[model samples]
Target: MTSMIQELTVSHNPFDMTPTMNYSNTTDSSFTNNSSTITNNQSYDGVDDFLLPWWQQTVFFLALIAILIIASGGNLIVIWIVLAHKRMRTVTNYFLVNLAIADFLISVLNMPFTFLFLLYQNWWFGTFFCKFSCFISPCTISVSVLTFMAIAIDRYMAILYPLRPRIPRRHVIAAIAVIWIISIALSLPNLIFFTTVEQSGVTLCTYTWSLDKDLAYNYLLLILNYIFPLLTLTITYSRVGIELWGSQAIGEETSVQHDRVKSKRKVVKMMIVVVIIFAVCWLPMHLYFLLSNHHPAVTKLDYIQQIYIVFFLMAMSNSMYNPIIYCWMNSRFREGFIRVFCWCPCRPCKKFRSKLRFRRTLFPTSVNAMSEKYSERNGSLMHTMTEYVDPDVNGPRRVSNNRNIVRKSDDYL
Candidate 1:
């Protein structure tokens, strides 16, 4: 949001004039009241481009709404998948929960106000939210990228030093706290700069910082929020991938070793795909902000508002795609999503089994028969959900299902 946006307001209501284009592509940039000149009974050329052609508003309105639903909904499901299920909880997945929380917060707080502000060319949400949204958006963004770094590093450590102990739950919680603290500290400038401005009758919410400060901060965000984290993820994941994949041949490895390697590979692949999506989705917006801040006059070109709309959409849409990625790339997450949204049960649904067991328990004469039934049904449902610590080491816990399928530390991927 270090980008600056100022709209030139004219004092005229000429009949047959179309709605004015009051938007600037300066991120954290919107139709703002920063311009000094005001003309009476005069009109500006191409100033009415933002809100004209009613169909553009209709389409974009719907698109933003869709993004709101999917990003928030999918992230909520992802949170549930990790927290509500025992098997999904792991050292890396704790970071994922933080990531999902940050993304979900963006979907709720940023999307609606952004759309309304863009559509009306005014700050309709008021002063408190104006600053809060600006503050929270960058804060959450910082949290997500940092959490990505955490996940990558955790996976790297778990795979590279399989015998070493992993981070405990308490330490991971402390790390999440530290991530938030750092994010808020970085975002203080946004809170300071963001305010509601009054011009003519229009109200705008934006930062009014000096040009040098804005550019410095934008560049800082570029490095910290986008570039630095992108590099960190790439390097870490590349190394992790090498460690997981560069191993013994099929004929030489035992079944247990093979299964562990395969699980780690699947989880690593999913994370790599997620990081790539974040990079690709945010590139255009980052470039636009960089260019606009560097060359202020570029904001005044014909059709520039439309271009910003496209770039911003691409960036904001980043939140919505992650849930789909989780479902598509990982079977466990897919099962969780299905179990939640579709009301379909995971394989070996226990609802019927529990009912049958209760019925058998009601008849004392069938005690031996109940034991036989339980044996035939395999391990009890409790065993399916239980996670046991490996006697060999203190890394991630080993999980057993009804069929006694054992997964190493990386299965939470």
Candidate 2:
């Protein structure tokens, strides 16, 4: 999740607006016609002026297309896993699935046109697609980030206080709906401020905002992209760390506590790593934009300013990397991944199936099959390893034995 992603290439103007020079003779003695009526044409050649050298624009768009394809494919796999596996379904993972869905839509919507725009720096898809695509990209990114924040909070609670009741499925659905509604609300600015303008006979997709709205736009982006969400992460993780590690009872255990300690530590470490990666990838981009807004003079540092665009794109890509981390670092996810990939041996699969069948027969109808399966498998393991008896046993054998003992006591009396 924390690896260095490839950066976006530098953007250059696709159209040539440079002036052409015309040469003329100063004096001609033999010519009867007037010698000097030269017209200056400022108009640029459509084909010649926009003639892109072979290696630059086309190839770059192709690379973007490749990334888009990978992102779309990978997100689809995640969605499939979440949907097909009942074990993968949870209030938290439900949100994650929604996030992936949004991100997949964003990748599908933005990347193709992004390539088109890069190739010509023009909007041939008309004003509607341009506005729609622009709105969708940020909307998805917002959903992705906010969902991550929610997940972090969920994880913190799960780890720090495992005894508490989980957030319900209905609220999770409601929360995801609200997130989308808010994301769409934030995206409305694009619908209002984006337009297609004709310049030098070429249509360009660009932001069209009044000066007052530009400031508002920058402020809104800053808040939504960085400030508010970082605050959420900071507060949640801080409390989580305190509750996990600050308890005296856990710290005081000394004899045979290594396994519990290590397991606890692993969970904490993974969350910490996730938080750090999110911070590292996004903080710089937000700071760059925030500073740039405050001091327009910072634009004079062209190279430094260019770095911001690269970082922002990198941050966007971070949305997809969380699932990879979950799969790698979390044992439950690793098992799910193995099952999905069909890496488990046939023997294990058969045994697992037998266990499932046993659970279904034992539990009958009242309990959920999945919960019954989990309980049966674990209880079977414990039963195999240790001796246990039912406290409520009142079978005929026990009743007969009790009667015999009482009769013998009466005979002795």
Candidate 3:
């Protein structure tokens, strides 16, 4: 949160990152080591004001820790799954890689720092980090939303005109570079203006911009990061939805065509779900800021801090969902996760082995054992036999000959 949150001292919205015009008591101590009482005004009760009950605080800490572990671990595996595998190097997966990178960066940097910033009511890290933290927050968010928009457009192009040549890997590389450039450009103001300011007796990391300027930039963020992307996705995905489900499959009802149509539907549905989640998670935060800004008196509500915590958690949580969603919806990703788990001796994925056993298509060394048991079982190929695993192809005993056909998605999805 920026110094705008500093206004929380006098019964204001403590979590508001928009900075307000203010004077400081201490000289610039951003780079220099100063032990002043550092706190972000996002908390009405400053650093010394740890008035919340222990139970209430415990829930918040636990939630933050959960987010840190899940976001980091999940996104790390997603990155590995895409980069480490050859067949997974598809157009959409590349965009997913960028999305995962942004989330990973946020998970590692934003979650812990923000949690500590709230709990201790102090900025333990130095001034450089103060600015870096604020900059990276918006930058990563922009990267995510922008990447989502790009996916929508790419899907629009690929589906609406299937025969058209898709963007090459090199151009996608350039597009990724451009996404970061725009994100950095949009967030550069935060890097420049947000610094640690010692106000009254407490130090806060904030921006010193006047009210109009600060709110104007915030409005930009709201539009570019939330509103515009939402509109774009709605339009593009609407057309994509029409193209995919609006018409029947172009062939006689057969297993192959049904599978192709189903795969296409699955990919579209997965992307739509991801877009929906992005909208749901960030909507509250944007609405909260708008509500507080328009009606300043709202901040005086007794449970306002509690309200902000929920919105903040939802926003922070946006970073962690992409990986789980990928593994849940995409077949290749699920297999890759299983592979990673198999390699690790500790077998962190053991807990979820039962869940993954059904859909995943795995190559086990115990094929002979499975073949021997195949005669005993009825239609079980993988789960009951415990040899070949692919949850998607749960149909009649998957004839081994058609295995390659199921793995490829670019053909239809």
Indicate which candidate wins on TM-score: 3
On residues 257-348, what C-alpha lDDT tens digit does candidate 1 reach at each position? Answer: 44555666777787888888988988876665555544555555666545656666677788998899888977667767766654445444
lDDT per residue (tens digit) for residues 66-158 in model 3 = 888889889989888777765566678889899999999877876677666555545667789878877888889889989998888887887
Model 1 local distance difference test score: 0.64
Candidate 3 wrong stretches, greater than 4 Å: 1-47, 249-255, 343-413
Give lDDT for model 3.
0.65
lDDT of 2: 0.51
How many residue pairs clash in each candidate at the backbone level? Answer: 5, 0, 12
**Model 2 lDDT per residue over 1-413, tens place:** 43322111111111000001112122332211111111213333342333346665455556555557656765776677667755446665587688779768866777566545544545687889767877776687678778868777776765565546767778888988888988888878776767666655456666666546645665676677667887888888778667556654423332212333344455556655755666676665556555654554443343432243245345545555665766666554554555555654662532233210102112122324212221121122111111111111100011121122211000000
RMSD of candidate 1 to true structure, Å: 10.6
For candidate 1, the TM-score is 0.75
Weakest 10 consecutive residues of candidate 1 by summed lDDT = 10-19
Q: Report every candidate's CA lDDT.
A: 0.64, 0.51, 0.65
Alpha-carbon deviation at 204 in model 2, angstroms: 2.0
